[model samples]
Target chain A: MYKFLTTFLPKPLANIAMALWYFLLIIMNLYCGIAFAQGTFQYVGW
Target chain B: MRLLIEAILFAIPMILLAWTLPKKYVLLSQIIITALFIAYQSPLSFAILGTITFGNYYLLHKAVLRKSIKFVISLGILVLLIVSAKILFTIHDHWIIPLGMSYYIFRNIHYTIESYNGRIQNESLLFYLAYNFFLPVLIIGPINRYPEFIRDWQRRRVNSEYFSLGFQRILYGFSKIMIIGSYILSLKLSAIISNIDESKHWLKVYLETITVVLNAYFQFAGYSDIAIGISLLLGFRVMENFNFPFLASNMQEFWSKYHMSLTSFCRDYIYTPLASYFRRPMLGVFITMIIIALWHEITLPFLIWGSLQAFGIYLAFIFKDTPTSLVSKNLGRVFVFNYFCLSCVIIDYELAEALDIYKTLFFIN
Candidate 1:
């Protein structure tokens, strides 16, 4: 399994060994979006 | 208003699917999509959608596994569809563009093509529809290869983490669409560009060209983000269509960053073969670019847009074997990127006035 993980990923991305790494940063930022939005629709953009 | 309502309806089903059964849900999801398109009062397009779905489905089966004939006949049929439905928009001049036609059409034929190439395992009808008509990425797509997309679909088993991850993607998408995209859209870059006087501040043309490219990316990315976000809320994962594309250092990289799925589709289906046939890399790039332009619309501006990129990419390919590697690649990237943006600026002009606007670029008078 370790060998498989090393081979499957690009060297730069190998640190994110879990299968879900592609989405980790995105998930963190989503909470940031809600915090930024604070329920305001007018100037809050989208 | 209508866009907002449609957006809501779009997100609702995918969320439910994630909650219920993520992997198998595309089966249900596709059925809903076909039904929704019909309800959208574009029932006429049902023929177009249904025909493409079944046509490729049957043709690929016969051509590949059955070995009824080589791939030529199937390829020919797809080309004919492209010409009539996509190109002519109907010889009648009164036909409507099919709903979600381009994405689905491309998906259908592409699936068949890959299957024929032995790149994919046999997919069930359920997976097929989900791939073709998956609502999250339907209108705009980060088009998934059958193998990659299906793997993701089948493997998905929703849990709290999945919900949170999906929500995150959706929220991020909404931020791009509702906020930044709105501002870029409101700028109406083309309108501003058109009004600028040729005599003074003439650099406006270049500025406008740059602006048009930015606006287009934002608008497209914004919509894609919304799609991504909504699907997330529903606990489904849709691949992203855009990365930080403008940051792309070269035409090749730009494509990888921007509208990635479409670019990959074109590359797989069009570019590589053309390159191989010509035995001169430039020819393939040029021809492939034209196909990309034609996909945008059968118009001169779009053709020019596609042509310029092809020409630039061809130049880069020439530089591939050159000694001044880094500099040549960088120069080629800027040239293609600028040309791509400028061509879009011309495309932004009114169809009737496009020629005149183009003339203005040269004369500046």
Candidate 2:
């Protein structure tokens, strides 16, 4: 998957896509973190 | 949040050390860092874990050198007693199991068995300690083998690709845990179930069960991703723990994929020998399932859960040779997936609650 993204797409476009994906993950994590802080999210332990 | 924070904090220094440490000092640095991390988390856990690890190493070393079956048996019994005590204590609320005790004990057992089989080579105590205390996998593990770890260490080097891949993997883990698991399956699904009309009891129960199972999958697989990613960054490629188990078309395939490391370990250490001894493959499957179930917790519900799983596997085995087409294969996948989700209800709830769920599902009440 990494190779396909980096190789098939143009370098600039690939970089943009990667950035967008990372941005999505960061936003989700931040939202979840806030939910956790509010004690609305359940944390499962191993 | 605290665990995630501590893992990140631990990873940064470990990554730096992996990249910059002198060759001779790398092992020492790893040992010290891991020791400090464990001690910081809980001094009692550190002490107990330290004693078990060192004691196991010493006994294993002697058993290997002397090739003494008596020593090996004694060591095995001792380890078993410790694990049993921990489980019994936890069940009775008498004491807390030391951090990562389950994972490390299994590692020690693996080492002991392999050493007795002459599969293990002579290694220094420090190297053995490093393998046991390796922080990336200490808590939740892929149950990495000693030989693979030693090989990774021997050939380790700084690699940019590994670093990039590791970070990407960690990002994937966090996303799965936060967005998909905690948010969608857990919170949203629970809210949906609670808001359902009480008359739609079956729908609510089914959804709740699915939510619990899927939530467990994501949470576990997410943590595994984080552990694997961290190991990658540290230049050790640990074994993969999961492999898209829901896509399995049969119970055998599901077991092989879900919790790949643990299942494989049980297959190797438990099932094969039991099967050979009893000359009954079905008995092996049953015993292995029970062990896997009880490994999570020693409760009556888990025992029943394990029995149900074994029964499911037996049914699958009986139907193994049946002809299959595209539709049948898809049907098989659905059956396998639902079987797992439903069986999981047993382990997730008390016997009475689970019975209530089943009664509701079948309209028994």
Steric clashes per prediction? 8, 0
| Tens-digit per-residue lDDT, B157-267, candidate 1 | 556766656555555555455444443333344456677887754467567657656656765776776666665554456666887776555666676777877887888
Regions of model 2 farther than 4 Å from truth: A3-15, A38-46, B62-65
TM-score of chain A of 1: 0.38
Worst 10 residues of 1 chain B by lDDT: B178-187
Question: Which residue pairs clash in candidate 2?
Answer: none
What DockQ do you compute for every candidate structure? 0.07, 0.57
- The TM-score values for the models, in the order shown, are 0.75, 0.93
TM-score of predicted chain B versus true chain B for each candidate? 0.82, 0.95
In model 1, pairs of residues that clash are A45-B178, A45-B179, A46-B178, A46-B179, B15-B234, B166-B232, B170-B229, B173-B225
TM-score for the A-chain in each candidate structure: 0.38, 0.82
